[model samples]
Target: MGQVLFYKDLWKEEFWENPWELGGLIVIGLFTVTFLFFILFAVLFGLLFPSEQTENEE
Candidate 1:
């Protein structure tokens, strides 16, 4: 007999029975993590180096 694959819940549980779905999940997860880090660093940089407004002096 052949083995049957199924889509498992990643949030509630661990391990993926299907390779195709697991690959998709991994790719999406990586992209999500990258975006999260990018946003975090952007906010930190903005706060640390805020632009200043100045008027012309005589």
Candidate 2:
């Protein structure tokens, strides 16, 4: 029996030629996920805690 790999994985030599692209992709993906997490947290935090208003009496 034989196994098959994706086209991207099949091109091992070509893939290593510019490995930085893969690293960049990983970094970009990490940042994207982090950005999404921060956005979600920001929305949740804002909904959970609204700003308090200060009242001044003369």
Top lDDT hit: 2
CA lDDT, every prediction? 0.77, 0.82
Please write out the lDDT profile of model 2 over residues 1-58, one tens digit for every residue. 1344665566776766777978988899999999999999999999999987768633
* Quality of model 2 by C-alpha lDDT: 0.82
Whole-model lDDT for model 1 versus the true structure? 0.77
C-alpha positional error of residue 57 in candidate 1 after TM-score superposition, expressed in Å: 12
Q: Give the TM-score of candidate 2.
A: 0.56
Candidate 1, residues 1-58: lDDT per residue as tens digits?
1222333344334546667779999999999999999999999999999978768633
Clashing pairs in 1: none
The TM-score measured for candidate 1 stands at 0.60
Query: Per-candidate TM vs. native?
Result: 0.60, 0.56
Name model 2 segments beyond 4 Å from true: 1-13, 16-18, 56-58
